[model samples]
Target chain A: MAEKKRELVSGSRLVDENSLKERLIVIFTKWEVILAVLIVFEFILFSNLSPYFLDYFNLMNSTFTFMEKAIMALPMIFIIMSGDIDISIASIIALCSFSMGFASSHEIGAAGIVIIGLLAGLSAGMVNGFLVTSFKMPAIAVTLATQSIFRGISQAILEDQAYTKYPEKFAYFGQGYLGETLIPFELVLFLVLAAIMGFVLHKTQYGRKLYAIGNSKEAARFSGVKVDRARFINFTLMGLFCGISAVLLTSRIGSTRPNIALGWDMEVITLVVLGGVSITGGKGNLFGVLMAIFLLGYLKFGMGLINLSAKVMIITTGLLLIIAVLLPGFLDTVKARRKLRRQQKESGMVEV
Target chain B: MSIPTSIKTITQRRETSLILLIGVLLFGVTMRAPNFVSVTNIERIVNDTSILIMVSIGQFFVILTGGIDLSVASMIGLSGMSAAMINQYNPGMPAGFVLIIGMLIGMVLGMINGAAVAYGKVPPIITTLGTMSIYRGMTFVISRGQWVTAHEMTESYMNLPHGNFLGISNLIWWGIVVSVIMFYFSKYTKRGREIYAIGGNKVAAKFVGVEEKKIHMTIFTLSGILSGIAGVMWTSRFAAAVNETAAGFELQTVAACVIGGVSIAGGSGAVVGVVLGALFLGIINNALPVINLSPFYQMFIQGAIVLVAMLINTLSEKRREQELLKGRQQ
Candidate 1:
């Protein structure tokens, strides 16, 4: 009778173990679920706190506040995922915008000005890529130097002058709304771009290579991954995106200055990291990043409605960044402790 | 053979190239502006760079441990603002006392960062980056977006930087004293050697019984204390304190360390190299205005110099490795 009781208990424990595995898998696979819940929570909290938060027009207009930054964050995801960073993105925007402004001042056509802006950004990225790949320079140091150089050039050229001569139609990219809809054109662009980026990062073989390289560069190289090429392309893509962001930002502001988008690199990086991308690399998804952008965008919007100072908003963002980084590790530790306790209990029961 | 050996030595030691570059720059500036080399002008340059030297010394320690403190500039601003506010409120508070208070505040701030990085397992860059904004925001909150003007500052506070100590300015004397103390500490102390070892190979160092967490906290705290001291000196020298004061100086400090041949990768740097780095930047800054160059050129020149210095360092390091490989083959 005792032997029979032991067999029954052991069988029940097996069932319990299977159920636990399923629960763990669900939790692990649904990382985006947490982010989605947080977004809803934030939406509810903000709308209840401020009267103006629920207005469609106010919400649409608010997207412009961070649309440029969101656009850049798309490419930043890939860069960070590949175990590299491009802090020079903001500076690239400054340089590209300044170039566009210069071209506009010289009576260049709108199309020509746009082309010049894109070319300038591409060239800047190429320089960063070349130095990093050829010389084996640390990406952070290389970009940091280029950031200074690019911004310096803009400062030298502009010298406190604001350029406002862009053609009227150019404003459509930044300020226009979808016809009869409350959606912003820039938001539409962001969504389309995010889809493309998501497909590329999640569905493509190149993306897998990026993860491999990020996890272990030498191992990835030995496995025949073209690490250098991928890194170079990612950086170039970063510059290209920066060019687009510059156009959008300049259009929205209706002017360009050397210091435009100054210190924005930090904000963009915060968004990317908050989106679940690891700073040390090799893990993250675009879905989390999209949710993060909206989370922060609305957070700022809600705060703005309540008349919080910019300094306070910045502090909140910083605190949010720290929390976002710390929370995952905290959760993992908690989960691990629980599992350990469960194992101890199971073993004790088995012995009994 | 002798000439080649001397040349090799000059190139092998990074500081020698920096010193030679400084000499070349001075000669060029003196040629362009005859008064550039005057004792008064030289003294002025030293005075201007005193705060820079102090901050760089702190940054060097953090970087030597393969970590960075991006919040140093913000710490400077906060400490300076705190010092100014204390002076404003008390009016009778001694300058020395206020300085100590400022440093204590900085230490508390640094401890927060150290705890986050060491105990919380956050990367140093991310931790410092987050704190940078938080501290800067705190500065605004403390000052209520107000500036402390020269009129509100005590006479002694203003005199701290300008006051003569022996034959040199008080600021230079402070730099000299700090550098000497740091030099001795880094060279003679077991903790200092452990910092370098940890930077060189973290896992190996840990296996050898180095308490990395404690050392990380200590270095960051040290950096904060030094930044606080620099803050006090900055406010004294300028006789004004504002939330934006010392903005972007963190990058400048890092640049100074890099230019002085302090590897950003860490494990190798010296107090002497860092001081020379500050002096090099100071001379360039002083010479630019005197040479009648556009103020705009200064930013470009500074960026170019940093980039070139890094490139040179990389090339030299590569060559050194190649030589080592060749020696092994033989």
Candidate 2:
């Protein structure tokens, strides 16, 4: 099987006359290109589905629906790329938001509240990192436990009450737009953070180490990479982003409840995975994730415009996740089969 | 220095630690509320834990193969709702038939998951996660946003769980029967050993002629069936069925398995350990209300216990590995 794959690759390379069809196939095979096409296709489909979808104001506003999750997805790429996962992010958001709400209720200044929220998130992340690194626990199990703990703490603190009295200026973070441009402040923040994360993930030695570790932790460790430290940093980075998202989410909603951001972790993970990041790690890019965020954001917006219930939307997202993970492998198998058939035909013809 | 003796010692030590932890928890709770030890309370705790125990056994098989079924809770909801709907419309149907139908519903869903994970080559987590939503959504679609109330249930259906056989709740009897069957199957059956072999080392198992994909399919299907049975039991016990019947129960099952010394990495653990783990959690749940802890603290304590249990499992696992290495060296 390995030899067959190699032969096919070499055979394709030897055929230097690249036809237009072949060129198109090559371009389409690139994940970014396919994603770009899908995004455009979704935009048209959504616009056609709902008359309000095409409105510039609605399109801009829809960005808020997923902006917090998008921000978290930025750091998540690094974590997933490092071959670890953190399902506790949504719980971290709840905890951080609760802390911010508590501070606000106690008459703390806006800046102080934001700082407290961020610190809470940071500490939560640190605990996750500490357990995973020090005890060498599985990342999934550790994060799963922490997710429950963090959410539980938030529940214990808030009970059924929600905190809503934030300073008016707080709304600007989530609700504000640039003068006359229809660009939301939260969207701007996400884009800026995305750029920074993209740069760090693609252009830095640190990013290379992450990929190396993801590919083979033992190999990376033997090669003198501080695998555990890199993972720890990645986890902490995820927490920091979670805190930022919590602040933005709380501000956007204009309240903080213990159950706020429930299940957001799964959504963010879906975004990353749909973006073409391999769940087993060591592959994927920021551009694909960025495109995926828009793809899903617009999808939900379009579906919402059609009056679909949240339950149906959940089903759609779940189906999309399965398809996104399965499609690439399916395509690869198809390609391999076609190649095998072609090889057999050519060999038979030569013998005849 | 022998491998078998060393393995035995490790297993014994793990069970001992679990027992010690359970004792301490019981002692503490009793000190706070002596009434918790009353016969009726103990019976209630045992009865309540029956559903968890059954579901955990199912989860144990999957975990033994180094996989997880995130969709078990959804399976529970679907099966429970299905069973309730059947009972509501067919008041004359036998209760046993309803239970069988529920199990069948679960088996079919599990088969879908198994086929996807085993044949479609999708990751277990992703496949189960997707199915989890799909199944839960199906429950809503089936019920059409309506809940089957206790008043609507047939008298016999409602009485099935409450009815006693030989001085124990029928629910407890079901749990014991399921556990015994699972214990024997895993210990004696060829397919059962295949499950452990695949989980222990997939490559080695394959080399030794184990059909990995088939085993994956079987385990997931079994998990679904168990969840289905639990779903029926849950509906009968509460005499109510809703789309949200077993929300978040999958996590509890996983926690139980981990606490029972089942390695998430797969291929080790016993039915007895799982039963003890369920008992520990059951005691905690029952004692919390008795001891006057706010209901809000339950989630926090459960989460803490899971983390602590996992930590201990990991540490002990490492020590056992070290000991095995030393034995080999000697």
Candidate 3:
């Protein structure tokens, strides 16, 4: 009779474990689910707290505030996913902006000015890529040096002066709305870029190589992956995007200074990491990053609506970055412990 | 050993090379501005770099363990502000006591970073980056956008760093004392050897029964303590504590480490080298004005020096590997 009782219990345990596994799989597999739920929670909390937060017009217009960072975050996703980093992006922006300002000073048309900005960005990024790849220097160190070099050039040139004279058409990239809609040109550009990044990250051979490199560079190299070349490309891509961001930012602000986009490097990195891209590399997805960008964008908007200081936003973003990293490890531990406990109990019961 | 071998040994030490560089810098500047080499100007350059030397030594401990404290600048701001506030509210508080309190505050902050990086499994860069902002924000929150200006501080408090002792400024004395202690600590102590072991090879260190977690926490805590002292020195010297105190100072400290030949890959560095590196940077800063170079050129020159220094270091390291390979083949 005891043996029969044990068998019956074990049989029920098997069924219970299957259902538990199914639930766990869904919850953990879809990182986006967690982000989506958090977005909903934030929306509910903010709308109730601030009367102005729910307006569609305000919401659509607020994208301008973070569009530059959002666009920067896309390439940043690629950099982090490939297990390297480029902290020099903000400085690259300052460089690009300075170049465009120079071009404008020479009466270059808007189209020519944009080209100058992009080319400056591309060359600056190439400098970083070349140093990192050819010399075999670490990305962080190379970028740290370049961060100074790029910004130093701008500071030396600008020297407490502002460049405010841009052709009228140049502002449209940063401030214009879509045809017959409330959507901003900057926001539209960001969304289109995001789509391209997401596709390239998820669909292309290059994307697969990034993952393989992130996991283990030596192993990937042994498998014929051109790790340095890939990293160099990511950095160059970073520079190009920085140029894009600089143009947008310069347009939106209508001026360029030595300190333009100061500290955006940290903010953009925070966005990428919070989006589920791991700093240690090899783990994370693009959708998770997109979800994170919006989650944070709206959070900032809501915070602004409630009349909180930007300092508070800084603290909030920092905390969110830390929690984003900590939560996954914490959840995995809990799951593992529970599973171990259940197994031990079942084994102990059978023995009895 | 032969004379040639002895000279080679002396030149091979990174500190020797840095000293040569500093000598070259001094010669170059003296050529431009004869006043730059005078006793008073020499003292001025060292005095200006005293805070940098302290923080660089602290950063050496963290980087020695293959971790970095990006939050050092922010740590300085917060602790300095806290110390200034304490001095403001209670004028009679001894400078030593205030320093202890400041260090304790920094220690706590460092422990948070250490805990996150060591036990929590967060990468050191990410951990420090997050704390960098958090601490800076907390500075604003605490001070509420207020500045503790010169007149607000007590005379005794201000004298802690700037006050001269026996014909030398206390600032230079503090820099010397900290450098000596760290030099001994890194060279003589068992804990120090353990740090080197772990950084050199973590798997091997673990196999040999070294406690990685304990060392990681201790490294950052030491960094915090030193940063705290530097904070006190900074605000005391400047006679003000504001939210932006020591802003962007982390870069200078790391540049010092790099210029000193502290391997960014970890497990090798010397206190003397770091001191000279800081001095190298210090000389450039002081000489820039003396040479009639616009201050605008300062940032560009520093960045260029770092890049050149880094390239030299890497190329030399690659050469060393080739020589080792050649020996193996033979």
Please, what are the lDDT tens digits per residue for candidate 1 over residues B119-203?
8888888898899989999999999899999999999888877888688998899888988998888889998889889988899
Clashing pairs for predicted structure model 2, backbone only? none
Segments in model 3 whose C-alpha atoms lie over 4 Å from true places: A1-17, A20-30, A345-352, B1-6
- Better TM-score candidate (1, 3): 3
lDDT minimum window of 10 residues, candidate 3 chain B = B262-271
Candidate RMSDs in Å, in order, are 4.6, 2.6, 4.4
Native contacts present in each candidate (fraction)? 0.49, 0.55, 0.57
Query: How does model 3 fare in lDDT?
Result: 0.89
lDDT of 3 by residue, A118-183 (tens): 999999988999999999987888888888899999999888897989999999888899999998
Q: What residue runs in model 2 are displaced by over 4 Å at the alpha carbon?
A: A1-15, A345-352, B1-11
Candidate 1 displacement at residue A120 in angstroms: 1.3
User: What level of docking quality does candidate 3 show?
Assistant: medium
Best by DockQ: 3
| CAPRI-style quality class for the chain A–B interface of candidate 1 | medium
Deviation from truth (RMSD, Å), model 3: 4.4
Residue A294 in candidate 3 has what lDDT? Answer: 88
Q: Rank order by lDDT, top first?
A: 3, 2, 1
Q: What range of 10 consecutive residues in model 2 chain A has the weakest lDDT sum? A: A10-19
lDDT per residue (tens digit) for residues A1-352 in model 2: 2554885585576366456675566557667788899889988888888889999889899999999999999989998998889989999999999999999999998889889989998999989999999999888889888888999998987888899999887888888898778999999999899989998989999988988888889989999999999989888988988999999999999998888998788789999998999888888889999999999898889989999877887788888888888888887787678668867987999999
